[model samples]
Target: MAHTIQGKKQLLTRVRRIKGQAEGLERALNAETECLAILQQIAAIRGAVNGLMAEVLEGHIRTHLGAHDISETQRDNDMEAVVAALRSYLK
Candidate 1:
C-alpha cells in the first residue's frame, strides 16, 4: 500500500480518465450514437482499466513478495494473497 500511496496522484489521474470515458459512453448511449463508435469507447475504457490493474498488481508483487526484509512466511502469505486476488479478479 505504500507504493500505492506514493503513486496516488498518477493512479488517480488514470482513474479520472477512465471515469471520463465511462461518461462519454453514457452520453453516446443517451444520444443514440452509432454502434461502432460506442463499441470503440467501451474498448478504450476496458484497456485503460486493465492498464491500471496491471500497474497496481506489479507494485504489490514487488513491494510485498520481492522485499527481502520480509520473512519467508510473510512472503508466502503475500504470494498467496496476490494469487487469490488474481483469481477473484479474473473470475
Candidate 2:
C-alpha cells in the first residue's frame, strides 16, 4: 500500500520497538522478575501494539476512503473520531 511506500521506515521503527518490548518481556520472564513488573511490561507492549494498529487504520482510511474525493474531508474527520474512540477503548 501507499503506507509502505511512504511510511516504510516509520512503520519499521515502530515494529522494531515492539520487538524490543517483546524481548524485554521474555527476558523478564526468564529472569524471574516480579509478577507485577512483568504485567506492567506486557501492558506497555500492548499499548505500543495498539498505537501501531491505530496508525495502520488511519492509513487505510486515508488511502482507500479518502481516494473518492467525495466527502474526503468528512472521511478524514471520521477517521480522527474513530482513532480517538479507539484510544479511549484501548485504554
Candidate 3:
C-alpha cells in the first residue's frame, strides 16, 4: 500500500525489534529462564506485534477508507479488504 511504502522504514524497524524479541525468547527458553521472566518476555513480544499491526491497520484505514478523493467502488473494495484482513487476523 502507498501508506506502507511511506512508512516502510518505521515498519521495518518494528519488525526487526520483534525479531529480536523472538530471538531473546528463544534464548530464554534454551537457558531455562524462570517461568515468570519467560512469560513477561512473551507478553512483551505480543504487545510489540499488536502495536505493529495496529499501526499498519491504521495507515490502511486512513489511506484507503478515509480518503475523500477515492471512488465509491474503490472505497467499498478497500473496506471489504480491511474487514477480511481483520477477520483473518482475529482468527
Per-model TM values vs. the true structure:
0.96, 0.73, 0.94
The lDDT per prediction is 0.96, 0.85, 0.97
Q: Specify the poorest-scoring 10-residue window by lDDT in model 3.
A: 82-91
- Residue pairs with clashing backbones, model 3: none
Off by over 4 Å in 3: none
Put the candidates in lDDT order, highest first. Answer: 3, 1, 2
Instruction: Compose the digit string of candidate 1's lDDT tens values, residues 18-49.
Output: 99999999999999999999999999999999
Better of 1 and 2 by TM-score: 1
Cα lDDT tens digits for candidate 2, 10-88: 8889999999999999999999999999999999999998888888878877776667764867777877877797788
Clashing pairs in 2: none
Each prediction's Cα RMSD?
Answer: 0.7, 4.8, 0.9
Question: TM-score of model 1 relative to the true fold?
Answer: 0.96
Instruction: Identify the runs in model 1 with alpha carbons over 4 angstroms from their true place.
Output: none
Residue 51 alpha-carbon offset, candidate 1, angstroms: 0.4
| TM-score result, candidate 3 | 0.94
Candidate 3 local lDDT, residue 43: 100
